[model samples]
Target: MVMETIEKVIVNLGASDIDSRLEELLIDGILYAFQEQIMNDDANVMLNEFGIVVNALGQRVKPYLPHICGTIK
Candidate 1:
């Protein structure tokens, strides 16, 4: 399912969006981990970084989509 979604996103968005989408995917995993509240400072830091990157990606992509899109939404 993930691969199929990736294919669809790739087809809809240009090459530049791939990096943002990839980061978005990774951030989802991190956010899940954080939401589950798995203990560990290192894990928290990693998740925080993922959130930061995801935010930046969203800032970049929001102008294009300008609506609900990507893993964050």
Candidate 2:
């Protein structure tokens, strides 16, 4: 399924866009990991430079990212 999405993105947006969106994807993944408390300090460094991931290894990491988290309404 992920491959299919990647293929679609590459076909629709071109392979050149992949590198440009890499940072967005990384930030999204890191945000998800932080929200789920599943990421460790050794595994994340991109946001650490900004002190955005202060509790990466904590049992309950915070969700301070700007993106919206969908929920049943």
The model with the greatest TM-score is: 1
Residue 49, model 1: Cα distance from true site in angstroms: 0.9
Q: What pairs collide in candidate 2?
A: none
lDDT of each: 0.48, 0.38
Candidate number achieving the greatest lDDT relative to the actual structure = 1
Clashing pairs in 1: none
The segments of candidate 1 whose C-alpha lies over 4 angstroms from its true place after superposition are 1-24, 58-73
Tens-digit per-residue lDDT, 1-73, candidate 1: 3333443454466336456566556545554644555456555464445444445455564443422234224
Q: Write the per-residue lDDT of candidate 2 for residues 1-73, one digit (tens) a residue.
A: 3333443454565434234356456446545544554346533442342232223222222342335234100
Q: Which ten residues in a row have the lowest lDDT in candidate 1?
A: 64-73
Q: Model 2, residue 64: displacement in angstroms?
A: 11
- All candidates: CA RMSD (Å): 9.3, 12.6
